[model samples]
Target chain A: MDGYKGFLGLLVSSLLVGFLSVIFTLIWVLHYREGLGWDGTALEFNWHPVLMVTGFVFIQGIAIIVYRLPWTWKCSKLLMKSIHAGLHTVAAILVIIALVSVFDFHNALSIPNMYSLHSWVGLTVVILYILQLLLGIFIFLLPWAPLSLRAFVMPMHVYSGLLIFGTVIAAVLMGVTEKLFFALSGYSKFPPEGVFTNTLGLLIVVYGALIFWIVTRPQWQRPKEPNSVLLQPNGGAQEGAGGLTVNFSNVDTPDSKLNHEASAKKRNFTADEVGQRSTM
Target chain B: MDGYKGFLGLLVSSLLVGFLSVIFTLIWVLHYREGLGWDGTALEFNWHPVLMVTGFVFIQGIAIIVYRLPWTWKCSKLLMKSIHAGLHTVAAILVIIALVSVFDFHNALSIPNMYSLHSWVGLTVVILYILQLLLGIFIFLLPWAPLSLRAFVMPMHVYSGLLIFGTVIAAVLMGVTEKLFFALSGYSKFPPEGVFTNTLGLLIVVYGALIFWIVTRPQWQRPKEPNSVLLQPNGGAQEGAGGLTVNFSNVDTPDSKLNHEASAKKRNFTADEVGQRSTM
Candidate 1:
């Protein structure tokens, strides 16, 4: 919102790229990994990667970038929070289904689970992801935590969200590779399935890189509102953060003995004037 | 340098993670991919993953983080640039060798080159990487380009370096998976070699995530010098990026009809004073 030049273009491109990756992953899962069928056998394993990519990677990217969209800047903060948390909620459910499919498939085949590094890292990331969502809601969305604690955890929430996103993408890469190796380990001189799977993996990587780059570009951060300054820890809000910030902390209702003649231009003042202002 | 509280810990941890990944990768290549003896055959292909990870992934990571190390900040900027570029040069050579081995093995076996998505993406990343290095040197280290152009491209150069680094990591993941799938397609459900290769892949992913996270953290950026602000695209340097900026654009070199008593703290100026400044 703070003038991320071409933000719309970038967001659309990110969504398109993410969609392409999901499609490629689905193709690999359905056509190559296992045919699309719910016979309650190994065919159920096909749901794992497809759902993981769809819910975890593609939808997850959307949830992260939702705030950066310029159109959402003026919407109420709570509304945006609901939309954000809602998307993540759905994504988490899909991830659950994805995980269940893998587990059920493993049990059906009498194969072991969590034995591969992919399983170890994948489960770790998903758990961390769930914790992140819960904590994000507690700190930023819900009013239970004090503003000070929310301020303190906000930076980490942002950082860890990105970190987990990257980790999940990496886990997906490893999972596909493991599957490929497991499925077609003895093909002579690179088979056709190898090309398809490698391409799908490549798309996932590209999709991830694009979304990370778009999300992290410093200039793209949503501009903070003047009232939002109160959200900053210690009240030392960013003044240079584009847009003329007006501090209304000292202003009070006229009935509260407020000076009616105070100059509007001199908005910023020390904390001495705090209680003069009326509560919202 | 401006108080990334646990920077030292993060840096140390990053290096350790990267080291572990490289060692594991080397183990996989040596023990499983191909034996030590080249024998003028497929054994040469062993060098591909080992050399790629060593040069492109591991050493390249070190090269990227060199700028982030606060201990080196006060050293001559030119020295840092040389070290950064020099490390990248070595990495590029190793990657060339890695590529050569793959091509040699492919040709020896009458297998095609650039046939898979891995080849396409891998080759593209390398080409972009080579161009990025050359462009970085020409625009930054050398004084050939005008300062305006240099400033304009500086942000992009930084961004693209990280992007290509990520793309290459993705390519490596795909390559290893394809190789695993190709080489071990018929193993009995999760073989030992698959475990080794999969674990190595996981390490690489973790290492990439750590390094990327470390490099991108804004607060962790190496603090700029007083004169560094002059490096801005419009030749207008930032005052104290935190606060307390001063403007002294009008101050002449002392005795040249200059006001000798100009306030030292008043060095930060507004936009009106921009064009009066000289360029490199």
Candidate 2:
């Protein structure tokens, strides 16, 4: 488990660095285009956004693994595990498709054909996010779950769904913007400008900040220990039990042997004798 | 407490509605301008972006209030109370300023320059938001606070920060894009194009989605109750004669009083006698 966790952590961090590199590359490309007095059409085909989004997906996967570690428990633990498993499964399948398309594993699959794969993967991520959102709603409604857990889980569900939503928006935006910008420049066959692409980048950053807030807020109430005996009736004596038994009727006297003998005799005595003894 | 909570809720909801309504109005105005064939000079003012941003600020304020209400603890409660007091004071001042500016109350005092009060109140609202953010940060760091509280607070911080950030970005973008587009169109000033306006609208929506995601994601570990007794030692006891006594000793039998008395006597008795007494 530790080894797997470490691997996932490393994978996420590496992907993050890669994503940052892609962003820097995009900035550099933009600056380079401006310096060269070239229009948007003269720029090379850019895969930076794609790579950055892929990195984000990997990071999401890492989040799932981290939340599923053994020490997590109760509602949180359960919710995390469920989300982790569900999301990872879907993410993995999407990643595989993305990998195949990127590598052109099929000789018949042209660049144009890959676009469909990308779109499909993007849509799948969005759908998975929606499912997770429903799961969040369901978790909150569970009768036995703690209220505090529900409160905490609701925000997480919202945040993750938003991340996936943002990613899809960004992907669509990029596709549209690139096509529109190319078309408007009259140097390419794509559309002049896309409403979706123009807005995608700004949305991602905004959503990222929102998600960060949801994950960091403090909670007031939390689940107590599961054992009811700890809060037992009879002044909490059940909590301090250590496998010992005492009979009060047999040990009423300070003199232990005499008290025991007396108790033994009393147990055997007739009702009349017991009544007389009690009167005495 | 319930009344205060309800009032805060109503205030937040109203603010949110007002904020969104302003945006809707701006969108309506933009569409109206386009329909009226308003030319270059009219669009240069770009009042819509400013109004939309102002609306967003109110939305952020309400979101902060909503997030803070649930897990509010000692210092946070006091801080929130003070914030409320400050808001009331600010509201009163704003009202007085509005009355002076609108009804010419300042003329009675032979002062013609009280209109600056409007800007001052606007600035106060911004300042209040900053203070609320700082208080949120402090609340997030409190011990014994719920993990969800931290999760919720941090995202709110980020969302609020981003709304501020996005507003600045939008303002800058509006300025730059207007100038660039004007240069491209071979006019010193031209009415904002459908493309530019639409692009800006898209940016706002994208950012809105991002904020939604940030507030909803499940990355933060929910706060757990302390497992050790030392951390919450007094949790088990109810009120007692001397406040409360946590009985940690192991005399839990039904005849605990008798056993305790006998044990005290045994301490004075010889060791051999004590042993014999126990066996008996």
Which has the greatest TM-score? 1
Q: How much is A9 displaced in model 2, in angstroms? A: 24
Highest-DockQ candidate? 1
Instruction: State the TM-score of the second chain for every model.
Output: 0.81, 0.26
In candidate 2 chain A, what residue range of length 10 has the lowest lDDT sum?
Answer: A242-251
Candidate 1 per-residue lDDT, tens place, B230-275, comes to 3222323211111101111111121221222122212532221121
**lDDT against true structure, model 1:** 0.63
Q: Interface RMSD of every candidate?
A: 10.1, 25.7
Q: Write the per-residue lDDT of candidate 1 for residues A104-135, one digit (tens) a residue.
A: 88887878777665676789889999999998
Model 2: docking quality category: incorrect
Runs of candidate 2 exceeding 4 Å displacement: A1-45, A56-280, B1-45, B58-280
Q: Chain B in candidate 2 has what TM-score?
A: 0.26
lDDT of 2 at B202: 41
Best model number under lDDT: 1
Error of 2 at B34 (Å): 18
